[model samples]
Target chain A: MGLFSRLIAKVKGESGSQISASDWQELERALIESDLGVKGVSEIIELAKKERGEDIESSLTSALSSWLSTNSRQLASNSDRLTTVMVVGVNGTGKTTSTAKLASLLNNDGAKVVLAAADTFRAAATEQLQTWGARLNLEVVAGPQNGDPASVAFNGAAAAKESNASYLIVDTAGRLHTKSDLMDELGKVRRVIEKLTPVDEVLLVVDATTGQNGINQAKIFAESVSVTGLILTKLDGSAKGGIALAIERETKIPIKFIGTGEGAGDFAAFDATTYLQGLFQA
Target chain B: MFESLSNKFAGAFSALRNKGRLKSGDLSDIANEIKLALLDSDVAISVAEAFVKQIEDRSLAVLDDVNKSTNPSQAIFNIVNEELTAILGGSARRIRLAKNPPTVILLTGLQGAGKTSLAGKLAKWLKDQGNTPILIASDLQRPNAVTQLQVVGESVGVPVFAPEPGNGVGDPIRVAKDGIKFAKDKLHNIVIVDTAGRLGIDQELMQQARDIRDAVNPDEVLYVVDAMVGQDAVRTAQAFLDGVGFDAVVLTKLDGDARGGAALSITQITGKPIMFAATGEKVSDFDLFYPDRLASRILGLGDIQTLAETAKSAMDAETTAKFEKKFIEGADFTLDDFLSQLEAMKKMGSMTKLLGMIPGANSGAIKKQLEQFDDNELIKTQSIVQSMTPIERNDPKVLNGSRRARIAKGSGRAVSDVNSLVDRFQAAQKMMRQMRTGKGGMQMPPGMQMPPGMAAPAISKPVQPPKKKSRSGNPAKRALES
Candidate 1:
């Protein structure tokens, strides 16, 4: 199955034009399988049924479009001062890699970018970011291993301010949302950076393949740090990234960017039309 | 905001109450709800559908038989558990060592699936099992992937074979072949090849994995996957099955709150047993996967077996006998008894782990309460109880305003806190008395009810729980009761 094809196939698999009970059930299964979640799928099915459209595909697209907002899709940057983007997420969701990719994107656009290796918890995490910084030829400020991450973010903010950099990307350690202490540490890091320079965007990097718990991750992280946007990573795989839609619906946080592959050039701005087309593509 | 899968099943079957026989409509309703729960947990659509259909058919046939149990839901639950266990491959499968000296194991998965971390954990596990394992850093595709593996190897006290300094520089296939040779020359019994995390659809990288597998000819190829993975689990598992053909599955990041329906999806689709699970970030968090435990967890029944084991170790025989004697005699379960039980609970593990072992304990207000719970609360309760005289400990009814004030002063807590502790203890004592008079009826906290048939077997099924059954009860009745 490609993206929402499992659900779309339900509509196309029917012999007649009119929708049947089994078809509806199959559509429900498809939506649930796509990670829309049981509740979200139930709401969508109810709405689609009420609309009584000519087909199931367009109704679901419209239902999804109603929940999605394209206004906040642009990466917010402060014009009068340095824009600081703080990236955070659960373990192995590619927060560090997304931070590097975001910095590289801003740097490639003729902007001076400084990367902050603030992930002082995970082993070799600092080295991973430093290697990316060295490859991109961007300045990276880091602290000692197992040191305070907030202090490192503060240092990165100071370095960006002193160097007159256009942007400072702070990459925090990957911490599960269930860990309250780790979440508090993230808040402290954000507050420390805010003391030097306000964080313009707190992007919660979510794996495209994450299940229903992705909503919990988004909600809890937003509660901790007021997450400004989402960065959906690992889209090159078989996952359709449906959780992004569900998360956006629940949190009202727009996805500013997406990671298509492992390469630095595989990122692009989130376009709602293109994304919806991919989702509903037959 | 979705109810746990076990809760969903409970809700669906709640309609079956007072019904004499299981109707087809009731069966389909239960099946439909179960299907939704499975999907919510990220099980593949086709697999969930097939599984629900099979269970529905089996349940109908079983219910129509002559040997019908009184509780229809319990019968259905047993059928579902058996089918889930069967689909989960019955039991945990360990690694098959090579007949020759150097056994090779290949690790493969998608990007950010924790292949590198799993490599370290597997190496540490093998080392702990009295085997010399060498980690091969063949993940030359990602930036500094080799450094990450080397750091992991160093922490685990295992040597890493990274012939090429990996920054998209060297051939992983050649490195894997050379790694095996190096391992054999050094007399290492095991060689683990850690490959780059790649897309299942990426033909080039999938071919790279295949080439490495062919070159190494490892004894086992483990497909590591994130437990939080959703619908894509089927597609990716299928892709790997066709592209690189793994021998067993290893689920990582089980520490996360995700229900891990991907375990069911991958296991059922590939017909491969899940061998191990990486629960936390540490190498020591890795262990053999238990299918029965995961099945109950996925169903939202909690890990009763693990909880029983932990409680059995922490709870001594004397305390069990004491508690039993008081219960049968209908004696008041005093604050002192509550304090001892609290101490035993503290010894069992963290409050979070204990709370997680109870059904329906992972949601709503209980979750909030769990977050607020700490050992200090237990200590304060202990202090408040200790401050009381023996008479007051025996009967909290004597805890009037003056005594509570004295306890507050002695425990260094507010009077209101001491008063609340006494009130809670009195409430607990009353509940225990009611349980005794109710003939050992299943007395669960509000909203934490186990399936009717599941309560009795929980203690005996997990491990011998206390083993202080009343000798006066009828033996045959006890058998039926259990």
Candidate 2:
């Protein structure tokens, strides 16, 4: 059977005059299927069952949405202070692109933005940032390839200050949380950048498609750098980003951005209700 | 990260450990635990449910056997392990380098999933296996992607067929065709085509990847998924399967502390085999994915086999010969040797992953220590060695007060740190000399014996039966935990 038709059938079953014990079980399965995780799905079921009124679907959806949307999804940008945003995440999670997209957004909004390619370890990382910079008509501050990322971060902060840019976004190389030296290096990069300007936002970019592993990455990255907010990337139209709901609930870090597509302009401020709607939809 | 999940699975199975006859009800709790463990590892709920249900059904069938003499729990463990391995490792060793030249391999994945790195690693591996492999830079979407591929290819000593540098958003289809043709003409048997990935899987991105696949008509269209990828692994795999169907899945970044339970869902749901695993960032980190070994790893049986292979792989032939001549025949292990050993071990993987490979080293406290393992110790050691003069590196005695102070300053370390490093180096040298003279009967890990003089890491712990590989066979059935 088609997934859409099955979901519709399940929805119809849920709207019955009286919800049966099987109805709750079905509801539980539906939530789990949506990527809310076992923990999130169970808790949501309990919350919905306890506080649910006559309309079960609405109560559950609202519960899931409310819990996801509690975090204040705003970038730490102030008029007085230069916003130094450091982007970090696991390898292959669209960190550099997200950083550029954020920079593109700020630049379009008439904020002076400087891209700092602090991901000196990855091959052609600086060039990738430069290409993004060229496309957006912004300047990128890059260091030598395979050079000290900390120095590059320092230079980025310095360049932002020199150019009077509103935002200095430092794009770090994707390092696994399991690597302690890499984590320490990230911490060192932050400290180095802070020497020049206070790091306004330590944004942890997570792929929405990530599963239970997201929680572990979030917790570790958060512990290392006081990861202030999250950027959920690669959520173009996938149902699996449900792990984000669980991660959001657990880490308590609000997702500030959603990378919708590959295009430089495809990023948007995450709407919890809209995301939850996407999850519920077939 | 998998420790908790392993603990849950163990907790569930622990109930049936000493039971003489298994009741049908016993399978339920174990099944539930296995299901939870799978789900927690990020396996899709439906897939987890289906897998556990099968395990439950199989356990019941074993219990309802006519011959009540059989060990029901062992049967269940065997079934679970075999099924898990079947899903993971059954379809492995599938990459048959085309008998005809230009056996094209198109790699697809979400952006930043290490396609370029994989391409390099695959080329090196194929070359190591006596095949001429050339990399095709078909990922024209990302800026400087061709350059990046070229860089990776150069590092691996493989040639990369790339389009001329410009706005790299040139026709990837055209590039792919040209690359395949070039490999065919050059008589390179293996062609690895690296494609671009969108931050999100959009229509255009899919179309571009699809177009490249059609153009290449690759022998192997390997879907490279980051094992660290959580919930979205199955959906993404499904989308790729539908949009640009791949032959197999390659799990990358396994060395990363990934609860990549998504691998289970991808294999179980899509029926795709996880063919290869990229354990570390280096080109050498790539290896054949062993489902049996991985299943044992998930079950908290330490990965002794993979660990030994990692150590063995670290010792290239030249290094092995050098060690044999330098350490075994001529002299004791030097600071230079210590530094090189550190480099090799570091290349193997992160401390956490390495610890996971050691049998029973996954203790809670050790796992925690591994989390905070001063991985920088390798870098520090390297820097200290690099700071020293050649004479000082070859002979610890050469490192006098002035030299120690100078080396420490150069490496951005203190004199005390340098002194300690030298002291450790000397002690390690003495120990290696003793081992060379058979003073300590260090039991080398099985399946990893190589050329003489290759430093057999002091494995004081008992050599394990390679996770569950040996026990999964009939002959070693007696060794099953009673």
Candidate 3:
């Protein structure tokens, strides 16, 4: 057995005994070894220690579950009526692909949806979004690749208002989150969309394989615009998916969805309980 | 790695290196090389085209730099690497959370992309970070999806709030809203609403995800994707991002054999930092994404962190200490030690990544082949060793006809297989003995040069003609020639 598995087994074998500080330390060590990150391990350890005198396994599990539920609840309540979501991220991070995927997912759930390709950076980005729009047979507003992204977003929102579309998804240029000018451009787009229609959401498209760096990028993008949620993609690679823990711990942002494959149907909503179960299982 | 793409990269690099310098003719060749590599690796066509244009422009501007460099090949390599990295975005991103309690997270994805699995993974990740999370099973279409969420919830010991399974589709979203309220009342900080996944992207599904976004006002909406889907994954992610305005991406199944081209291209296409990765089915297998580590792995420079982990798992301190002591004393260089080292190597995932880790292992086809050998075969060999009696294992001479038959039966293999194993082991032992004695009898095997920085080459090289492609389009020929 690997060192991590061995440690987990050692801890699990002693589940019935009174938990000691050392045992908690071992568990924390195991978590760190598993790539849970320092912040996550310490947070879990502190919560586990609060129930030191109780059933160790149950307490640890409950503490973890409660912690996850608490974090997710914070994001859940922030969603309000006419919540507009402005999706922005760097190019090739599945920005355009994710836009179509998200549009299909929302449309399936019976929401009035409209898509706008405001990614005026690439010549074919608008066409790519248009292709998905055709497949879904949904209305799409698009501009030339080198045209103004903010203008496209404004026009798209105006179309949404005209059609009384319940949800308007504005696809923006894929720019570096660290680029102040690009980030400022995102702010302009968000403001323009809100002027046309109430902007309810600003979602950052993040690749799951980026680890802690993904979290750092999200922070910068969040600062630039009113980023309300996270959309993590490409789950079927070599990346360990540890950024999920780091992002929540450091940024306290609720992860809304996960993309497991290239299919349009590969997305699913985030569930803390289910996530914990998958995390703890061997 | 995906076999086809790996071959393409190898072929492209070889061709580029052979040309020695950048020229207008080299532009088409480079573009074609890159196009084939990206397409074979499953990068979206549009993205690939844009990348090629950018590379072409950059390459033209850096012609002087390439011409002036001591090694033109290395210079080109740097240019390609730099451009690829830039297109993928130079850094990662974090999420935005509201200051208030009860932040809602709307999760969306297609069916069979491990959306449910990711939901569980995300929940555990959040909980470990001190956030109180509640799971909302809003996927009312798929049969047993609710139960699946509950099963995951029960496993994590977290409460799963969902409408009764028999309820209609819309009911789940309503319950999700109510669950969010309940979680808030209970002092929970986050509510993750796990939505249903469809077989394909359609208007209905997009509406559902958007409806939930409208109803819950989630702080974040994450789109889940499977990385193995390659270019398809990138395309799907874009579609979903447009529909729901998801905040970030959660990639799953990173441990699979996917070339991970999608991961590289996705960031460039979306301008988003990959937030997290699901390496294995186990919850602990999740990790935050790192572009540099991924780039290193892709470039065939083995990931050090993964390598360290493998070593820690496979090598005990006592065994390492013994090996170290023997190396220092110059007395531990035995055939037995070599065999044991081979055994330890079997525990790592593959020979390819390991070989790539060693100095000078990246030069030739033979080295690549050795690295890519099947781990299952190694396991079979390991089992064969286990089946042998201690005497037969330690002393190969003890394995006569009767013993060989017995061993074959124990290992459930043909006697021929057993004999072959013994023969290979004996040949290896003989080679080691010859090396230790420092006799003129010792000579390195063909294609076994000890890398440039290591010990001096022990054998004269053979002059072989450059192999041409066979009519069959066999990649082995191309690889061997390169």
Candidate 4:
């Protein structure tokens, strides 16, 4: 059978009238087959059964869709003020890329954005952020790659304040979340930013392909710094988007943005309604 | 086998093996091995350090208790397993899907992690289990991803809903919304959306994905990854989790020569279960991942469960039924089946990786030989198969001189190319027949080795016939022959 036919079959499988009670067992199997972790499938089934009656399939679909939409919406809709977003994650998590992307998104929304290249460890990191700044035409305050990241954060906050930018996106050095010294450096950067201006948001940039390991990084980062939101990058390559549901279940962190691709315009804000609609579209 | 890891383990065991007592030095060696393995496998360095430290501390205190056991290897294995299990959590955790009918699954990953492929694979798996799935081609930036996805969708017989090019990545959310409404009108059940990928992690991409998440309101967000990336995959996963918190992880390319150290450590680091594993390129090459099997693979104790899971994940019920039917009918297995089998072998990862999986198949020369026959060659062979006419493909005997010329023209090759293909097919068929008849299986032809490298040979060697000599004619005949 072809891929499209199989997909159609899956969509048809949800038809309540076409399937018998024995076929319902296949629903769990279907979920597992779709890579929706076993626990996740059971959760969905239990939730669906509880709301069961007439039109169980539709009910289950809507229930699952709504549950996700509701949770994600609650997380992303956290107030409309300055909404300072500080990007954090280990090296190579695309922190720099995410920072630039966030700036572009905010700028596109008509908000003046300032980016702080506080990731002063890797030589290429600063240059990369600078290149992004040039492409997006956004203001960037960067320290030398080997310089103190906290200094960059302080300067960036000052620049944001002077420029009257609504959102100050700070790109911190990519350090292992489990490293105490690195976490301390991150804390210091946060302190510097707070001293310059109130630190409103802490966003952790995670590579979606790492599966649960990404979540583990989140846990450690959250411990090191009180992370407020998540930006899941590389959604385009990740086959198991289930990690988002898993992360939310484990950490209750709201995913603010998802990086679908490398393009500056590829980032999108998390929307619940469309997500629900997309889930059952098949 | 844990070829490299075995040496490390050997070093650790040797220290503890003869000492009749466990020392800090032995514990340190074991800890070092864990750290090195984790790092090599691409576990975040910090995570590796902390993990090794914890193991060291625990082992130091429990050495006396563990040393009392007669089997030192077992004791070490138990300890390592315990440490690994502790770090990874006791068991796997599952994602939290919505109670509604269309449970949304959002995929995220790095550019080369195969997220697009996973989306199709997942959709196919869902269809097999009797669910209706709509595949959304939301990856708007990458070159030809939508088309690739459409091809995948078509192959799986699933309908794909994609926004027009330049419509923006988030446009798919709106399209998906409309698709859902359409499905509702038509009563479709599930939708799987394929998103974009970046060369590296960037905030703009995350925001776009987040925007899609908001727009679509997906139930489960999965982080897809390439397991062969080792520690890099783990670090990247952590970054994504921090940015766009996902529900579970789907590890792809498990068939590669990855020690699977990242998979084992990722769960412990993120406190999330590896929901699924992708072992091959085929849509069916996905399995509902189990932690124990992964642990066993990491420890170099062959994971039969994982192997079975890989087969089950890759082969759909329909394909399996077809195979069963063919077996019952005692039908002649054709070249097409052989080609598919070869393709499947390629999907199991690099030749070196497959060899590593088999017991005692690890040898330097074998690894090099396996490396030679890579995926590129498989693709070329597939193209060659595609080039043949239906009759020519089904029956090699049908290709006479005229047919060979026609096929060569159609396939954009020389006549000799067609003849060689026919010969190879015939040879393969004969070998298959022999094997089926319980005769000796196919052996390597003299002086011919499986070509290494996926690229086609730069120069084709002309076919040579066996030379004959008349020994009875003595010196004159020998001179004449010379």
Candidate 5:
């Protein structure tokens, strides 16, 4: 797992010389395994080439880190008005469960929170949200099955405002990028929510195990709603260490939180040092 | 996306075709091109590197001959295609029907990986193959997870065995054990245990999954993986392999725009075969995973095997025969026939996705037409066509202004709707007549040229080589002096 040493060995251990094809190839391998796409890998390799025997680690880290924000990675916790965090992602990425976890995180912090079961598409999705709410002594606002998700968000906004809650996390339905009509409909859902309060954080929940195909999904969401952040879920500890860098580089969206487990308390803000250390860890 | 790579292969082959002999270094460009395509297709980085290396070695081997007279590119494609097929585990393996009754299949994956849905699909798929399957709702962790599996079970026409929550919470392992017992008592030959999934991998979840594995000692423990999980596919697979080793992997959500990298990486990473792939939401939309077919699809070569299967399932012999007779006889293609074909196509799933498999079907016009086309349009078309009298349906020209008005009134559609149907039917009939008379400019999908000795009919089927052989007839080898 000495991912760091392997990355820097060719530079630190070798005599000062121009980076050779083999060195570039090895770096490319590392980048690709990191879930960085072909486009991003080539771009990083080109950047690392200029350093020669210079501090290649920082040069490359900076290149990868440049896509993420330099500011503190925190949610919209301002006490001005209700700060709504709208969670969205394609199906099977744990969007619904992550919503529950996010609610729990906020609840644990003693922030008044209201959950909006805006995903009316799945048959038992609302009940799933309610069950999570019941565990934490929180209430979930939901609408009828196959109802307009935007209206559900609207109802949720009303509920949050009436309770004078500090935050509202709206869980939207899982949809694919290929369906333009549905993608466009997501935009409508956002505008509907924005009417009540700013959607300070529209986190696109992605599975850590997802490959390069997820980049396309993220790109679409970013383009449509200006996705503010990413939430990496299902990180049950594996080599998916590369995707974090690739997604940040591709989507230019900072990863805000990661779902470490299925429990309501398994989420945390993404720390750059810990993640970078993890990449070189194993 | 693979289409671009397919074109690149054509370019590379043509470049080699012009050269009299294969230079060892000439394959470097093709190797890089193929590598980029593999990465784009979601093949893991290290795995893609290894695969490209294999192709490079194979290509150089084809050039080893001194009297070298061969289509080197064709030889390279065969090698590359063969290696890709082999990496995908060669062939589809059906579910292992245990010698003893009550074959238990434990389903496990991260939350939202479509485990519950796959359980229902597996149960239905088994039933279709003449086996009784019962589902066990052991995913008690997620609220309503049990009820969700129950709903899926009812939809698939399979009975669900859910242990009532004891003390407000029942251990998943206990539920799994009791479910198998219930299956034995009820004589349900197959017991599919749908286990709980955490949003992420956790010690507690894995411990429970492992406990269930030990308790049941199931014949088939299938890890249901989402095809959309690209790079994460291998890592998650490795974790599951180590935590709760499974017999096979079940890929779900392939109907989405899956680059198919995870599907490619899982088998290699875990040394397990992908036994089944569930495409759409329907229980019937699942099939045994065929590596060769998937290879062809990934190569941007249309999946004729899948197309044939989809067609065969959707169309009865009588309907196909009637269509053939009408085409051969140059008979007018009626609205009724068009209605039936439309229904068949809709049954096959997304028109846009299906068209990707057919040569020359990825055109903008066709995609646009499919996007505009919907079930409502089909229903309206059906209503309009069905409203026509026998004389009008058989001979639409006889459908004058009065007949059209009467039919529109009967169908509760506008006069324009009826008029549009007749016009569209006439246009289609003209196209069919031209194709039937051999005057139509019909472009067949490449690799699917009409087989010699098989007369061209309106519906053209690709020359289906034996599925197991996987395009073994080498064009490059044939050109070489063996």
Candidate 6:
């Protein structure tokens, strides 16, 4: 059963008149299981209990949707100047794939785009991006193996400016946000891009299945490189991506896109209403 | 980000502290709190509820006999700990090998689950254990998946069987079946078939996994799960169990500060043992999973055994002998020795990770203290030691105020920072002296202390497990020793 249906069943127990303690506990569990985090769950539960007289579903929806931003989930870009977009996250969170998808996305939108393979740490990371660039038929700028990532970002920015591209999506190496040295490298990548032109959007690609640590990842990435938006990837799985709500609630950085599958066409803009409704759907 | 579930568990039990007798209401409250704790750690709702129910039943039984134990909370604690350990698979399980010549091991999981990297780690691990293992790149779904596997295989010095480059051009089932045949032909005793990461609900992909499974009839199918996975763990684990039927589980990205409640959920739902854990990004960061150790970690009691084992593994033979002699002769642990220890500890992994393994290190003041500590702290220490003269490093006693200031200036750190490093070193030196006489009871790394109630397992001296000899004839016992 969907989480909402299960929660409704929990509420409609026996006489179906009043919500019992066990029902509240069930609601809490549902939220916790969705990676809402202990603190986030408790806050929602407290707000939920305070509005017990009203429709539970509507009350919960309002509470959750309030945490999410209704702002435009579109990728920020500059029409006159080059728009530099940096795709970054920890290892294997689909940063490269999402970068390819985003590049294809912008390219289909009738905008000139260039790709940069700034991920030099992981073997075949550049090749991964290069392959995507080849499929998309877009130019890809990559650095030497194990070379400094910032220099690659620098070259990518140069290429984008030279080509007069509308967007330059720099795919950075996946590094754990907790690693200080690696985070420093990410900051340098940003600084290098900003040195040439202002970075329009720094999207942190998060896996849909990430737990409470998602909040920390968002916070650290935002702090390190001023992550402008979030791209929730791997949503093709059964995971509800509820952590995105918690992250948006905490960081106020809206999720720009959702990756439903491995294919480039599976990318879509985030819709808060659809997401909130989907959360409870069976 | 990953709050120690043990801390929450302790909070639950603390309510019943100092009570002469236990009531049913008390047990219920504790049970409720425990359910929340488990849920907070990303344990599936049904699994957490069932686990709490077990705790409630066990606690009520103990309540029936009031005089069974002096401490009711301790009794409950033991019950929860034992139950958790039992559910996590009470003993470590080895990878089951086939009776035939080439043992086919199929790796399956969702995308970004670290299957490609783990295949290499598994191959290298098998190679180290005197087995010829070859990796087969059958993950033809994701872009550059084949290249990733080939790169990982090359790094581990294992041959990869990739007849066709991935990117949806080749049939994975054919590759897997052909890879098994190739392994047999090449006389490779082990064939690790790396498959595409797919969602459990995708029928086509699920059928693909079944096709590969039926084609090669792998001896062991390992479900590679990301340790940071949340509530969907139950559904995904159940799907894989029913759809593909894995023999065991392997947890990846364990180095992240996630509670790893998915471990509990998967094992409980699928009845599979988690055989290995990929702790860090490095291929060598992989290790055999220990249920008792993970159980303790889940309960917020630090994983001291793993930490000690890591320390033992990180230390070279010469360093071990040197420390052993110095420890026995009651010699001072100089700055030079301290510097070397610091460097070796760096090889052990992150300082935050090391401290995180200590009991109560995740809580209040200790956690605050941990914020000041990171890998950078080790780099600073290395630079500080390098700034010192040979004499000063050999004998810290010769270092005067001017020399300390000069060293701090040379290291580009404040004089107070230098002083703190020296103070920490001296404290470590004193602790080493106390340890030699068996008086260093339950102390942690310098500036950290074990919380009052949590008694660290008595590691009187550095546990130096003999790396060369196999004292135990039993394979499992020997595996633990190693």
- Give each prediction's DockQ, rounded to 2 decimals: 0.65, 0.62, 0.01, 0.02, 0.52, 0.63
Comparing 1 and 5 by TM-score, which wins?
A: 5
**Per-model lDDT:** 0.80, 0.76, 0.63, 0.63, 0.74, 0.82
DockQ class, candidate 2: medium
Count clashing residue pairs in model 3: 197
Q: After superposition, how far is residue B275 of candidate 5 from its true place, in Å?
A: 1.2
Best by lDDT: 6
lDDT of 3 by residue, B125-158 (tens): 7887888888988877644567667767766767
Give the 10-residue window scoring lowest on summed lDDT in candidate 6 chain B. B452-461
lDDT of 1 by residue, B1-482 (tens): 12366666666656655466777887898898888778877878889889999998898777766136767777787788888888887987878998897999999998888899899999999999899999999999888889889988999999999989988899999999999999999999999999998888899888888999999998999999998888889889989999999999999987767777888889999999999988775677677888987777655667888777768978899999998998888787777787788788767655565657676565556555656655356566678888899998887666666777898999898876665454345445555666778854656533223211112222223322222233113434422332
Candidates sorted by DockQ, best first: 1, 6, 2, 5, 4, 3
Per-residue lDDT over B149-245 for candidate 4, one digit per residue giving the tens place of the 0 to 100 score: 7767888888887665422334655665665566556555777878776433577767767777777787888888666443345445666777777
Which has the better lDDT: candidate 3, or candidate 5? 5
lDDT of 6 at B240: 89
TM-score of chain B of each: 0.71, 0.75, 0.68, 0.64, 0.81, 0.85
- TM-score of chain A considered alone, across all candidate predictions: 0.93, 0.93, 0.82, 0.81, 0.87, 0.93
Model 2: fnat (fraction of native contacts): 0.68
Q: Per-prediction RMSD in angstroms?
A: 9.0, 8.6, 26.3, 21.8, 9.6, 8.9
Q: What is the lDDT of candidate 2?
A: 0.76
Candidate 4 RMSD to the correct structure: 21.8
Model 2 regions lying over 4 Å from their true place: A1-17, A69-71, B18-20, B64-75, B164-168, B198-208, B316-351, B378-482
Per-residue lDDT tens digits of candidate 6, residues B1-482?
A: 24568778766667767665788888898888887788778887788889999988988877866536777677777888899999898899998888986998999998888899899999999998999999999999888889988999999999999998998899999999899999999999999999999998999999999999999999999999988888888888898888999989999888876778899989998889999999887878888999888887777777898888888888998998997898788888788777787778879887677778888776766666665554576677788999999898876666567887899999999876665565445556666777778886647652224211111212211221232233444434532432
Off by over 4 Å in 5: A2-25, A49-56, A69-74, A77-81, A191-200, B1-20, B64-70, B164-168, B198-207, B321-331, B360-395, B398-421, B431-482
Model 5 CA lDDT for position B397? 69
Clashes of each: 0, 6, 197, 140, 7, 2
Better of 3 and 4 by lDDT: 3
